[model samples]
Each structure stands twice: as C-alpha cells, then as structure tokens.
Target chain A: MTDAVERIVNLALHLAHAAKPVGHESIRRDVFGYPKDQDEAAYLRMFERDKDELRAAGFVIEANEAGLYSLDSAATFVSDVGLSATEIAAVRAAGTAALSDPSFPFAPELRLALAKLASRFEPLEVPAASRQADESPSDQAENAAALELATRASKRVEFVYTNSIGRTAAHTVEPYGLFLRDGRWYMVGRDIAHDEPRVYTVARMADLMVSGARPKSPDFSRPAGFDVSAFIRLPFQYGDQEFSAALRFDQSAAWRAKGLASGLGVLRSEGDETVWSVPARDDAALLRWVVENGPGISVDAPTELADRLVSTMRKAATLHG
Target chain B: MAKTPASERARRLLAVIARLESGSEIPLVDLAAELDASPTELASDLETLSLCGVAPFTPDEMIDVFVVDGMVEVYSPLPALDRPVRLSMTEARALAAALQGAGFSADDSLVQRLEAATAREFDAAQAERIVRAASGQHAKGVYGSLAAAAGAHRVVTIDYESAGGAGTSREIEPHVLFAERGAWYVAAHCRLAGAERTFRVDRIRSAQENGESFTVDAADAAPRTATPSGDLPTARVRFDAAGDFSARDWPGARLVSEHPAESGDGDIAGPKAVLGPLEIEIPYAGTDWIARRVVARGGAVEVLSPPDVRAAVVAVAESYSG
Candidate 1:
C-alpha cells in the first residue's frame, strides 16, 4: 500500500508478466536481484509484492502446489462486457431486419453477419442511444443515408473528424470496428492524420463519404497484445495491486497456456511445465484467471500471489456449490 | 438600355429588392409600409435577391448585394423573377439520371413539370435517353405507392417474396418509405409480427392499403427513423489502404496498428504465410458480405476482430464452404 512497496511491486509485476512462461527464479531475481543472507521471509515479502501487484494490474494469477503460475483464458479475454444473450439477440435481430433497406446497401458479407448474429441471441432491447436516435427524424435519415452509402460503398471509407474541442483531423481508414461507446456509436480506424490509429464517434461526424478507394494496406499490426477494454480504466491493465505473489501449475496443463496477448511474449516449452510471466495493472482479472484455469494453472513466483488465487477460487466454488 | 418589359411578379419583386438595396436610408419598416407587403415577406425576398448576383461580366461588376439590420436587398439588371428558365434539357436529364440510379424519379409534380416544359415529342439526344436510363417512370411508381401508404397510416396487405422466394401475405402499418440501394422500402409497424419492419417494394407482389388515415409526423421526425446501410450488426475495420470495394472515400481515419496475419507472418514475400496482411479496426455493417469480399480479394485483404467477430467469420466461411 505504501508508495515504495507499490512501486517495487509494480516493477516486479510488469517484469513477471511481460514474458510468457517466466521461471520462478527469474521472477525472484526480477524483484530482489540477489537475496540478502538467504532470508526466506524477505523472499516471501517479494512474493507478497508480486501477487499484490498482479491483482492491482487486473491479472488473475494462480499457483499450483508445484510453484508455477498461469493466466486464465476465459477471465481475461473479453470482447464484450455484461452483455446478456437477450441483448445480443436484439442487436442481431434488428440488424437482420433491415436487410432490405435500400438506402443502406449491405453486401453479401454483411448480410451473412446479420443472419449469424440473429441466430445467436434474441433481439436486444433498444438502448438509450438507439431509442434517442429514434426520437429524431433527422437522425434516422442521416443514419439511413450512411447505411445506404456503406452498403453500396462496401469498401473502406475515409472521413474527416473534428474532435470535441473543434480540432480538425482526417482519417483515411477502413471500416472495421463499430460499437456504441457510452450511447454514441464510434467507428474505429487507423487514423490517417496521426498515421497511428483511433476511434471516431458517428454522431460527431459532419460528412461521410464512401470513396472508390480500396483498403490499401499497411504493414502494421495490433501487437497482438491489445485488449479493447483496457481503454476503460487503468486498474484492468497491468498488476492489480502492490505486492508480489507466487503461483504454481501442473506441468500437464502447460499446453493450455497459449499467448493471452502478443506482448505477453513467448510460451517457453520446457520439460513437462510452462511458466507465465505477467505484468498486471489490476489483480482481480488475474485472480479470476487462476480460479477459472483451476488446478492446471497457478501463481507460482510470489507466494502471496498463489494464496490469493487459491482463496478466491475456494470462495467462488463454495458460493456456487 | 432597351425598353424593359416586366411581368407582374417581376415588377412587384424588383420594387421590393430595389427599395432594400437603394438604402434610401429609408427604414425597413418605412419600405414595408410604402410597399404594402408585410415587412417579413419583403425582407425575405430582399434577402434572397441579395444572394442572386450576376457572375462578374467585367472587373467593375461586384456582386450586387446589400444587407442592413435584418433586411436583405439585391441589385441586378436582369429581370427580378426567373425560375431557371424551366429546367434546360441538360438539367432535366441530369435530374432524371440522378433519380434513375435509385430507380425512382417520377412524381405527379415531376410529370406535370416535364409535360409543361418539354412539350416536345422527344429530345432523344440528351434528355430522353438519360431519363429512360434512370428509370424515372419506374422509381416514381414505387415511390408513390410507398408514399401513399405512409401518408395514409393504413395497414396495407402485401404479397411478399424474399431472396429465396418464400412468399407470404402480410398486412403492415406503413409509417415511412425509404429509398435505398436503388429500391424502395416501406418502414412500418408489422401488425402480424407486432414489431417495426421494413418491406422492400420490389419483393412485394401486390400492395394495397385499406381505408385508413394517419397523422403526419412532426417535421423533425424525418431523419431519426432512417434505416442503416445494412441490416446486420456493424463492426469497425480500419484499413491500411482502401481496397477493391470502392464508391466511397474515408477521410476520418489516420493511422493504423497492425501485424502480420496469424498464420502468414512471413508469407507476403513467399509461400510461408497462410494468413495475409492485417490492419486496424473500423466499423463495417455486414460481415457476411465482407467475408465473401475478403475471399474474393484473393489474399489482398484480411479481417481482424476482438474474437467473436472472428469466430463469426470462421463460421461463415465453413458454412459457405458447404
């Protein structure tokens, strides 16, 4: 909790998590370099720091009795949050229903997506954003016109967006990700202005044009490590808390540990075992990770890290059972 | 200058514009009183005339315009009232072409205007051909049908068939009709399905509205209920460069984060890579169409998703394979 402890744990957690399949001794060295007088308790503090740090980083760290740690595939990997089946269904249903809308010309690829979504979930209840949209005729017309253009364009589009502060920026980007952010729909793209990448709110757009330009590709990549929700808050990213913790995993479950993110680094293939080095901004996500991975994965380096996942799992199981 | 012959409309309008522009230093209230027209109407005409300047015929010809204390005035030597000489053949053809692209460009007013203006049997070279190509007649018919239903608020029964040819009869309470993708769709509350729906007019075998009347929505309601580009859930896709799918340009995107595709990191130069190049996220309305498009691109493009969208793409691929 103190600043010094938090700083040390934070560094240790990042070092541990940045690389996948991190070794126990390497993690310890990452924290203490060389132990003073072989004091085991000092090592324990380091472990406490590591676990706490992982929790703070939003990592779910769990240790098996054997002293190896792993991340939970289910808990940390999320494209959607708090979405009910019904909501998903509604989105799918409404989307599919407009297939015939002439203004919004959807290509076969788009139509297939609608059909697929419709089959998966029930109709989603209209969110406040969607309902508010319905309240105005102009909004509906604009959306319709955009749909028509997008359907016919069926290719990448380029748009110029002025930020909330009235700054003008341009993005010659493809149309890839469309999701509502706080009730406003934003189109995510690689910003041509910064030449990096960014998101633009649909409502903020002044003009939208589907150009004859095709999706000219760049040789860039997402680092394979990007987590969409990390943009929501800091606690969910690196180590959850300020302490180091240890975790263990059964060597048999090593193969189950693939790369959770591109930057999580490589999966070291050792004899009958695998270790994951994780840097976390929050430990809750880490804790959840270990509980879900169960006996197969654990938080091995920092002792406290191992203990947290075990206790959380035990509690969770008890509550459910 | 030759003796100017002015019509009643031109004379009345010119007097109004002349007074506003002359700036007799006369107050706008005084001019309205002298003109015997409402100050509001006179002001509006003056304002409109101010915008109507002759293109510079010579260096001395500045745009003849005047604005003062909520009053609009214009100075022009030409007649004050000229409604574009009733649409030149070229212009008529252009309008018709614009209409035909969406398969509808006809209306009762349009018919009346065309009849009164053209009066000729045909202007085959310029206007007639283009108008025909635009399908001005057809689009008008489809638009009129839906417009009538939407105006009447009547539950209309339609014989419908889908892409796969499943025909059914349904009565839907038509609300608004929209033109999209060169077709017309009537948006309404489907009485049988108990939900809002859009019916593509081309898919309808027959449509008839029972005797009914409906209230006109407020003017502000026109845009909000409009349908989107597609009926599918949309996903954002940012591209490195706009690919084969053309007809639009995106100016909003700037940069992109990307990596080599999962299977084909080394494949670009040789046969080592299985997957192709990848780019950032931009929202796309339909994946099914995109999947086929991606496939058709022959390795020029790739799709990236958070996970489920990727899964959906895979599922679509496998299903399509069958």
Candidate 2:
C-alpha cells in the first residue's frame, strides 16, 4: 500500500513532466511505482485508478485522442494572485493557530493549504493559540467527525442526545449545517421523528453515527435559503414566542453595545444612551443577560419586562440585605 | 512510524514537488516543519520521489529531487506540477474556516483574494454558508492589526472596554495572541499597569501601532493562566441548583460545599432534579464584575460573604430596580 502511494505519485510526476503525451508502455517502463511483474491489463487498471485519484485531488490529467496522457499545466497549477503583506500575515497567523488546535475540524486540510501557501512569505512569529477550554480529546474528535459528515458529506446522523436538563433520547437527524458559538459546536438539522429543525450540542451527543446508506451522495438536501447563522441566537432568544425588546446602554458603556450585540439586532444612539432593538424569546433569560452584562445596561421597553427586572432586582437586593 | 494514508501521502507528495520546483535549496528540517512531517519521514519520501521519471528512464528524465547535507535540493524542474495545484474543496473550506475563526467574514477581502486560487468549480459561497466560524464582526480588523503588531513586537495603543463597563486607553507591548471560548485575546505588558494583562480582542474598540518596538522578555512571553491570582479578594456565593452554573464560568472559583435542598426551600423548584445549592468561593480583582454575574442570575445566586461584595451586588440590583 505504501508502494502504491509512491507509485501513484511517481505516475503523476512522470505525466506532468512529460514533454508530450506518453503511452502505457513508456509509463510502465519509466515510472518507478508500477509493479514490473504485473501483466499489462492489471497494470492498466492500476494506472487508470491512479489517474482518477489524481483528478479527484484537483489535478487535471488530460488524455489525448491518441490515448497518450499529459498534464494540463494551466488547469492543474495555481497562478500567482498577489496577496498583500497583511493578507499573508492574516492567513499565516490564523492558519498556524488553527493547525495546532486539535478541536478545529479542518486541521489536516488547513495544514495542506498552508503548505501550498508556505512559499509566499516568511513565517510569522505568532504563538499557538489555546484550544477551547474544557474540551476533551475524545469530544474534539467526535465533534470534528460530526461536523465533517454534516457539512461536507451532507449525511444523516444518529446520536443519543442529553439535553440541558439531563434527559437523554436517541435522535436521527438530517444535519443541514454547523456553527461554532462560545467555543462549542452546534449542529442544526431536521429531526427525523419530529420533522422539525433543531439545534443539538455536539458535546452532548453520544454513540454518534453517520448514515452509511450512500457514501458518495448526500442523504438529504438542505432547505432552500436555510442559513445556519439564523439558528445561532443569543442567550435570550431561545423560546417559542419572540417579541421585540429594547435595551439601553448608558453613555459610559455605549461603545460596548456593537461588539456585545454581535451584529444580532439594530442599535441606535439617542442623545447619550445607545438603544439596541433585539428579539427576545425568554424574558427571564433576557433579564439575566442584562444583569450579567450590566453596570450601564438596562431594559428600556416592554413595561412587563421592565417590571420583571425591577421585581427580580428587588428580590436580589433583599436576599443580600 | 505511524502509517500515512495513501491519499494523504499522495497529496503531500504533490505539494512537496511544488515546493521544491522553485530551484532553491530548503533545509530538510525546515521543509518537514512546513509540511507537518518529521525529518526522517520527509527524507524517506524524498528518496521515493527520486526514482520517479518520464518515459525515457534516463538519468536526465528521472526526477532530480534529493536531500543532501541536511537540505532538500531539486535539480530538475518538475514542469507542469512545478506550480502549486489548485485549492481542493477541503483546502478551500479550511482557508475559509481559518479566516472566519480569526473573525473575518465570508465576504472578507482575504477570502475573495484566496478564492481566485481555488478550483473554478468549487462553490466557496455555499461552503462558507454551510460552516460558519464568524463570532464577532468588529473583531476582524482589530485582530489583523494586533496580529501584525504582535509579530513585529510593536507597542500598540488601544481603546479597550473593560469587563466592568469602563473604557480606557492603554499602550501595551503585544506579546502573544491566543483564543479561548470563541474570543481572541492578546497577552501583553501594559505600560500603564506595569504588568502583563490579557485583553479580549473584541473588546478593543480601536488599535493603532505606536511605531516604537520592544523586545519580549522571557518572563513576559511566558504562558499566563486564565485564573485570577491568589492575592485577589475571594467572594463566597451560593448558587441555587435551579441555575445552570459551572466552574468554567468563574476561572478561579472553587466549590466550598453543597447544601441539600430543605423541604420548604423555594429556590429549588424546577423540572430538573435539584441537588441543592452550591457554595462557591470566587476570587475577584474588582467587585463590579462579580456583582453583575450574581445579579444577572436574578435571585438564584446570593453573595454569601465579604460584606463589600454583597453590598456591591445589592447596589447593582437596586440601581436597576429603582
């Protein structure tokens, strides 16, 4: 098998560097990997499979009408697109950091990508970034596998999910997309039994398995206009009913609203305070979020929410008093 | 040696050919580091590549890659494969993920620029939409600037919004940039504080390089623990079982003890099984931050000791209640 890898690589190099299309006899005689004891038919079969693998790896191997093979340099090779120093630094910094992070799902591909771009610039002195806090190696592997299957293979997956309340159940999901939030991976998919979209934390999944029905073809199609970003909501946006809510950041803390809001809702400035109009699905959670992020932030609308805040705070103060 | 998958080795071999085609001699150690392989393994791969050649099988037609005197040297131009191959679907996705993890958006200029080097048939937009790593919109530009500054060891002045809601300007020497919990942070020596502090990249409202550079001291570059130091004041707080709390929420907090729910304990009512209230001792440098966390949980959490912290929590809760 190792020799097969070498043989395939040797065949690719032979064809790519050939001055003109060379026939099977020439390849068999010259390329080092082809087994000398193999008969002509078996040798040809191996050659055809090698070529297909190379093509699948993004190489363009053209077979001329005369049955000779040659490399299409224009299609096979990447042309130089001038990248600014900053762009190179950006890629190198992020790419290097990601490569060292085991939790990052794309480490192997990222390593190859960085290798391709290695000659572009001198390596930056960026240190390796830390992995997500509290992530175990096993969880990282399973999460990466689940994400790979969900996004690239478009496969359905089955897992026993333990929800926040510790209730465990088996679920078969046609995973549509995946996103990273707060260093945790979440898969948004259609639940087979409920026939509705739901988000499941990858860490809470157990005995996860991707459908083996068709390895090459996707098991299900993502609904049209289904964007995973829409599913990644704030801490306060997780209930059945959603309503408009307004929170105000005092003048002193106004600068923090944009970054804290994370582009979720519209933020406007009136006088000195910054008012953010965002969607709220859980009033208790919203109040908690306000208190959690507050010193200068407070609820500004929906009299009921404001009253709840007041009552909750009164209870908190009395508890401490 | 761990067995290298045939497909992965094949891809790596192509990249090796492309890397060596430039005709410059690269040290085997350096090349192995770049390719994420060990030197011995790379040397073996080079030996394997040396036997590959075109139709003639003559010395001139054979691949001329070799490792000599600790350096990889290529004498013959590999021709068609001399240039890098197009970015495969996986490689393209990796690039997008890396950039997005660094806070760049799918439509970021760097993404668009790199997209040109991808295979024409690859659907980058679709791939970007499928896997999102973007956590913050404003952090992208800030991250780029800080990265370059850290690489150059330059002093940068930044407008930072602290966790307590106060905004201040600090000129610091950037040492290392790291990510934890989906946010990027830079550990640097703050001239104002005369100590090394980690600042979240997203909280930096603006950054500008001050042109002056400083050398990083060995101590300054040492890894800083996320936990608060022992000298900081500790606050004892009781978290009701109804509230979802974990040790991770407080970096330096330790669980003191657990008090089982009494028959009439009203705080323990919830659908989930309630174990009781948790007594956690949390260390803090300032009262405001811890107060906000306690008040944010409504009455589920109570500050149990250190009268100042309790007063701070009461003041914060009362400020909103009034």
Candidate 3:
C-alpha cells in the first residue's frame, strides 16, 4: 500500500506539474522507482490499482486509449467558493460550530474544506454562531457516505428509501450533489426511474450502494450544468401535495407572521390582524407551526387543515389537561 | 488537528508550489504555518517535488528548490503549472452553499466572482433557489448592520422581538453571527441580560452601533465546539424506533442509552413499562423548547423525568384547544 501510495502521489504530482500530459512509457520510466524491467502484466495490474487509489483519493485522472495520463489538477485542488475574508471567517466559524455538534455527518470533511480555504486566507480569531446544539443528529451515516462517494465518483447510486409515508422502496439515482438544509442533509440527484431530478433526504435513505462499487463502473457522467440548488426545497416547500393554505395572525404575532409571508404568498394587513394565503406543500408541518405559536395564529382557509389542527389540539388538551 | 490526509497534504503542496511560482519568496516556516503543516512535512514535500518534472528526467527540467536557514525558494520547471488552481465542482458547491447560507446573495459581486472562478458553471438562479434570505428586505438590512457590528466587536442596541412575542430594547456586545436551519442568529454578550445570549437576527427590529466597543474574553471569543453557555437542567425521555428519527437532531440532546425502557421503578411516576428502546437525555435551560418537540412527535416519545417538563408539555398541548 505504501509503495502504491507513494508512486501514485509522485505520478499525480508529476502529471500535475508537468508541462504536458505524460504518456505510459514516460510514466513507467520516470515515476516508477525500480530501474529494472518488469513484466507487462504485473505492471498493468499495479498501474490499475494505482489509478483506482488515485481516483479514491479524489484525483480526476484523465486518460486516452493510448494510455496518456494527465491530472485534472485545476478541478482536483481548489474551490472557487469566492468567499471574502469576512465571509471566509463566517464559514470557518460555522464549520467550527458544526464540528461541535457531534451528529453533523460532515464535520471532518467540513474541517478539511475549511482548512484548505484557510491556507489561502487568515483564520478567524473568534467563534461565530453555533447551531444543531438543540437538535438530534441524524443516524444517516451510511447514506451520507454513500452519497458522498457517488458524488465524488460522479456515479449513480442504488438505495432503499423509506419515504415519509413509510413505504420502503428501491431507487437508482445519479448523484449530483449533497446539500445541508434545515439542519438535515439531502442528496440532490437524478432519479433514474422517474428520469427527473429528485431530492432524497439522507435520513430517509437506507442500504445505500454506490454504482461504482460494481466491477465495471458505468461510463455515466452527470448532466452538464447540474445544480444541487434546483432540488433543495425549503421547509414549507417540501411535499408533493401543494395547496393554498391561509392563516390569520393577530396583532400580537403580526410582525413575525408578516415576515414569514414575504416572497412566499399573498399577505394583507387589516387594522391590526394580518392575513396570509400561502402555498403549503406540507399541511401537517404548516398546521403544527401554527399550533406551536399558540393563540396568536389562527387558520382561516383550508378548513380540513384547520380542523386537523383543532382536533389535534383538542386531543392534547383532553389527554394532558 | 487530526492526522493529515495524504491527498489533502499533496494538494496543499501543490498550492504552495503555485504560490511560490507567483514570485513570492515566502519563508518556509510561514508557508508551513499557512498550510497548517509541520515544517518537516513541508520539507519532505519539497524533497518529493524535487524528483518530479516533465517527461524527460533531467535536473534542469525538474522542479528546483532551495531551502537554506529555514527560508525557501522555488522555480517551476513546467510552464503549464504556473496557472492558479481552479476550484473543483464539489469545492465550489460547498463554498457556494455555505456562503449563500451565510446570507451572500446571488447578486453579491463576490459571489458572482466565485461563480466565474468555478470550474463548472453553477447556475446562480438555482443556487439562490436552494437557500434564500429567511428574513425580508427590511430585516435583511438590519441583519447586515448587526453582522457588521459583530465583526467589528462593537456594542449595539437592538429593538428585539423576544421569543415570547414581546418587544424590548437591549444593549449587546456583538460577538459572532451565524445561520442555522435557515434563520440567522448572533451570539453575543447582552449587557441588559448580564449574560451571553444568542439573539435571532430576524427578530431584531432595529439595530444601531453605539460606537461603544467591548472586548470579548479570549475564551468566549474562541470558536466553541460545544454549547458555550453554562450548564442547564437535564431532561430524560424514551423514544420509540419511529421517534428516534426525529429525536436525533434535537439540540443539546444525547442518546443516553439504547436499552428498552424497563418496567415500573419504585418511583410512583415511572416508566410506562411499554416505553421505547431508545432513551435520550438533553440538558436545557427551560421546558418550553422540549415540550413543543414532544408535542410535535405525538405519542412516539414521552418525557421520563422532571415533572415540570411534562407539565409544560401538557400546558402547551392544552393551549391548542384553549
């Protein structure tokens, strides 16, 4: 492993720093330390293993049929997140805070990412803000790792997903990107079955298997211009069954309620009370939010949702009171 | 720092090479410190780079390096290697996500510059769609002022809407600004509360930098990996398998054990005998937060200790029909 590792590192560095792509003969003659000649079969096996290891190490090694290899050094090394000094400090602080939250699946990765950026910039002296301190860390390690591998390899993945409805089913997806939203991790990918972009919450996924795990990795590549943001949905934007729901907030909570309604739905203020007609993709979550705000918020439209909230509240009142 | 990953180290070395080739004769010690690597490891990396070059193996064609008295000089043998490293797709996405989440808008020139530098085209519209400013335009302006104050270590008076829905004015020493779950918050030392507090930025109605400055204790300023505040009351709860999913990310919460809830103990208010398999303990300052969560989970979880928490849950649940 050490020999393979060292040779591959030198080989990659050579290619990365080389004036041009080095052919197979030049790599064997220059990169390989042993001066003595070797059998072609053994050399091929070693070279193959070296290539795999390099790829696993996150190097994009491009090759031609003629065996000319070049390192995709540009893409392999830097990220153009383009954060300013202050923004970088903010990110580092957040990364530190995330590291504090033990449940964050990407803590180590986040640190390394931040460190890489820190190398180019100064480290922030003070801590920023921390989050997920009061939240449960998801038990989605397997799924998270699988999605990471798939994204790194630019390969498809197969997994068993237990959707919100609790129906566990198998899915094959072309992993595009991994995103953190609302304290949860989600994979934005193309669902091969649906032939459309889909967002799969990592916590809901199980038995994740990267397509690259197979011996003959597919020649599959992500579509050009694939953006993870397209698949990410906000809290209120989640759920397929979207409908208009209205809520009225009394003067007491009008300020916050008005803020929530901005850029989301129709809003009107009457004297002191504020009314909002919002597009709700998840009625239960929407209703729960209203109920949690207590007496100030009242459901006005979607009588069914209002009824459910009222009944749920009534049941709680009956049981707890 | 954890044991340095070889790949990451290699990339850093490459970055050093690029930086060196940019005609800056940086001292080896400073370079090592900048890359967060030991001087020895960096020296070794230089040794490795010395052996690598273009196809032909010749001294002149190889990367040349001179390390003398802890200073370093480098000359790249390969002209093609002089270009600055571009950000990888994943790296770009990670930064874009984090920065946008931190409130950098698509229209922000820095963000646009990053987009231009990205190895792959990241659609600004799509990126904006993923995470938008949680607060409105007015609140966003307020957030900017508060964040600036925090960065400058200034004391600011803010008209804030408290969690209980009351509006009040407070003077706080701005420490740090952070975003979580789409909401922006500033953790600061509140002169009014006489304690360090986390204030939601959106809830801040107005903010004015008093031009008064306050120095944060170094200990308090350092990035905290754990909750910075002092200890609080602890609550114990049992969660069913289904409940575990939702309970996992609960803040200040830890899974105490995975043992099934045993039958009734000597205590009159004991386990219901049919409790779930997972038991979690969370330290909290108050009951309102945990109570709301328990109510949300319905019957999947139950508070096992602190009668106050159970009572709080009951009170909140009862308010629905009140």
Candidate 4:
C-alpha cells in the first residue's frame, strides 16, 4: 500500500494534470493510495483528508457543483518576479543562516521554503552567518510550538508561568501573537482567568499544552487590530505610571537614536542635536539607559527628571571619589 | 520513519519534484546539500516518488524519476509539477521572520521583493504585525554593506562611533558577521587597531566598500572575544539592595558576599523590600567598559577596591554631569 505522503502527491498530480475536473470514481480508480477492496466509507474519509492536506500545502483544489476536482494552476504556481542578484543573495543568505539556527522558531518551515526557491539561483559562495549569543533551545522550541497553535492553529494554550517577581501560577491563554526582544521571546495573549490580554515570557513557562479539540477549527478569533509589536515595550517602558521623557543626543551620537528608539518614540532634529521624546515608566531604568548609552546623551526635559539624574551622578561621583 | 512527519516529507518531495522536473542530472550530494537533506533521505524520497502515479499506475502516467550512479535524473517529466508551488502561509511567515532576524525590517525592499512570490492568500501586512523577530530599528544599509563586503572578501572604510561618543574612521577587511545578545557585530581585521576586532554594526555610522579585495587569514578570520586573556585586573564592587543587579550584568564576576542592608546605608525605593546588598569581584580587560556600566547603575552600585577603576568611574560620572 502506498504511504500517505505518496498518496497525497499522486492525488495532487492527478488533479493538476487532468485536462478537466475529475470525478470521485476516476480519482479512486486512478490514484495509487486508495485500495480497491477498501470499505467505501473509509476510502471516502481518507480521500477527504488527502484533499485537505493538499489545500494546506498551498494547492488550490476546486470542486464544481458536479463534485469534480481540478487544481487551479493560477493560484498554485508562483509567477516569475525577476528577482535581481542582490535580492536573491539577501534571501539566500538570510534563509540559509536562519535554517541552521537552532534558536530560530521557524527552522522547519524555513527549510521547506528555501528548498522550494533553491532552483532559482546559483549556489552562494559566502558562508552563512551564525548566532553566537546565549540561547535556551528549550525556550525556543516551546515558543515555536505555542506560536503555531496560537497563530496558525488558533488554539488556546495552558501553561504555568513564573512572573518577574518569582510567582508561578497556572494560566490558560488564547495566544494572539508573538514577538522577540533582547534575546527573549514573549507571547501576547488573552488570559482566560483575567479575561484580559497579558504578555508572558516564554522562558519562564512550564508544561505548556495547546488545546487539542477541533484540530481544524480555531478555538478563538484574535481581536481586530491586535499587533504583537505594540506589546514589545522598551526596557524603561515597563511600569504603572507613564510620563513623557525627553533626551538629547549630541551631534556626534545623534545617529544612534533611531536604532536605540526601536520605533517607539518621536525623534526630531534640533540643529546639531537629536531630541527624542519617549514614554518612560521606570525612572531608574531610564537614568541607567542614558548613562549606559551616553557620553553624548543627557536628559533634556522635565526639570525634575534632569535634576534627579544630576543628583544620581553627583552621588556616584562622590562614592567613586 | 515515524519520527519525521508525513506532511514535512510531502513538502520536501514537492520541492524535489520541482527541482528535477527540468530533466537535468544533478549529483546526489549536491542535491542533498541544496535541499538540506542527507543523501540517504533523498534516495528514499526518490524511491517513493518513483512509485507515485495516478490511477491504473500506468508506466506513462507515473513519475519516471530515479537515481543513477548517485545522480538524480528524470526521464518522464510531470508537466503539472514543473513550476514550484507558491509558498504556504506558514512558509511565507517563516521567510519574513528569518529576514527580520537578519536585521531586515518587514518594510525592507528585500522583503517586499520576496512577497511577490508568496501565495495570493498571504497577507504581508498581517504577517508583519503578528510575528516580529527584529528587536530594534537597525541600520539596515550599514548591515547590508558590511554583509556584502564580508561575502566578497573586500575591505571597506567605516566611520564607527564607540559607546563613549568617540568616533574614528578605519579601513577593515570584513570577515564574519554575527549577532550577540540583541546587536549585530562584524568581526573584522581593523587596520587602525592593528588587530581583529568586533564592531557593532549599529554603531557604524557609514560603510563604503573601497573596491579593494583582500584575503583573510585563518587566524584573523576566527571569532575573537573582546575579553583579553592572562591575569586581568579585577574590580570589587557593591550593589545596593534596591538594585536588580546580577552576575549576568557583569560577565566573569564572582560573588564575594551578601549582607543585610544597614539602616541609613542608602534610600530604598519600589515595592519589593530590600533582601540584601551584594558584593562582587568583577574582572576587566579595560577600565572604560566597566566604568560605563558602573556609572549606568547610578548610585545603586558603587566601586570598592581598585582606585584606578574608581577613578575611571568618577571620570565617567563627571562626563555625564557636564
């Protein structure tokens, strides 16, 4: 008997090569997977599953009112985009590197994608870039599994999460989206217990399980306009009360503002200086950020905040003296 | 066989078929490398494909593909599978996520160009919002230039600004591009420094390929840590109870001791009560980097022994006060 993979490929080829929509009798008689002596109900169920699998693989198989199926070539085949050498190199480099990175959450799917695009260009001579940073492979695996369920499978997941303050509790969340920040993975989801959306660190999660009920149907619909990037708060942006903080980057270090801002604040050029107005929730963290990134940066507005920074600096200088 | 999912194999088979449909003979090793699969796996996939066919399993209807002398050849091409299939939604998402991880934003031109090849149902905007891998707004142009130069074995001139706000121009032979923590670094042979150093790509103000090619020595191209070897100078520091300081903040730091915060030692803020103050001995290769970190924590951390480090920390704090 042919395996499921072989059977599915045969079904796809039969549909795609057919001159016209083929009926069920023709498929069962022609496809290699369905056994001739198999029960009628079982054959029908298997055939339906194969078609669904084909659809999931991006093949648009259409059935007419007469119950005939044909592969929609226009939708199934990608048209030539005439990619330039530079564009091809970028895709090849990034795809090749990420495919081998164990910490990347999408290596399996990326491998398939790169394999599909392999025939388009010549083999690149450059070695793929590698990640040298510290990473927890278990955390990455968990993140990938939960992300697939939350986004693609649209299933609810249950896990025990330990918060920053060392508190652990069971949580059932309808995961909406996922984002990576500062070498850590975060999932923004709706907590079933609180009935509100919350972000949880993937590393601190333990014993995660996705809802297995209704494999095809989604358990919940993500609310409209929900974006994971919005939940990616900067280091100093975490706290209850928020305030507008301004910092000035001297002309020498002005170029670093955009990369440091991470698309979270308003940056404008004031003569030779770049002034950034960003939201701050943690004053201490903000002060630390300025010092760590500085020599050319300083607090510019909210006299109280500036005074506090000066005071802190004076104390530091006195102690170091 | 049970370990590998059926759907994954099916995806690989489809790509294999698309690659072989041109009827060109390709070495099994080369093909395996291209598809990121082992030769044995490719051989098994080929055997499976050779048996797959429409009903009746006629010789003409079946896929006539096989490996001859470790080379893949296709005698009977299936016209339907000639063109590569459009990327599935999951595959497209993976591509976007990978590109973002490489410092390319969702709106980068490279991403937009690749979007044209995705399935019609793939929503680029939605994918951008749903999954984000890139942490910050990186200098994409700088990263691209350095990456290209590294690939071509070329020397490029760059104006790099250090964390201390000092800028210098240098010509360097680009070697390997790597990511540590959240930032991208290029390990290159710096002519100015007369050594192989890792410079953060974000700190590079501008990079211009000088059109001069250079050869990289094996030793020079090897990844090097900024930390210097040998008996290094160590600094003893104390952290206040209110600060969330850990050994991770200072690599190669050893915990000296922990003690309860003495009354009137310092003011403690925030909701969490002060557990204790920490004293650590941290080794340093240079005073500049350690001084910046100490000053960054403000008054929460203070340098104890090593008068040079303390003086350096004071200088850094004064630089900020000015």
TM-scores of chain B alone in all candidate structures, in the order given: 0.45, 0.79, 0.56, 0.74
lDDT of 1 by residue, A183-238 (tens): 23445455545665565656556557666545343223432333332232212244
Which has the greatest DockQ?
2
Cα TM-score of candidate 4: 0.86
In Å, candidate 4's interface RMSD is: 3.8
Stretch of 10 with least lDDT, candidate 1 chain B: B79-88
Q: Which stretches in model 2 have alpha-carbon errors above 4 Å?
A: A18-30, A62-75, A133-137, A249-259, A266-275, A291-297, A307-321, B21-30, B53-65, B68-80, B217-234, B240-244, B261-277, B283-291, B298-322
Interface RMSD after interface superposition, each candidate: 30.8, 3.5, 7.5, 3.8
lDDT of each: 0.39, 0.76, 0.61, 0.76
lDDT of 4: 0.76
Q: Residue A272, candidate 2: how far off, in angstroms?
A: 8.2
lDDT of 1 by residue, B1-322 (tens): 3322222212233323322223234456645543444667556544433333222223122224454775444444432211111222322333333333333323334333333332132232333221122211222233444444554355577766432224577877666544432234566666677766656555565666666654445431143222353333434443334243221211112124444434322212211212222343333333333443333222233455445555444443332222
| Candidate 3, position A266, lDDT | 76
Residue B1 of candidate 4: its Cα lDDT? 48
Candidate 2: tens digits of C-alpha lDDT, residues B44-82: 888877776655667876668889999999887763466
> What does DockQ give for each predicted structure?
0.01, 0.55, 0.24, 0.55
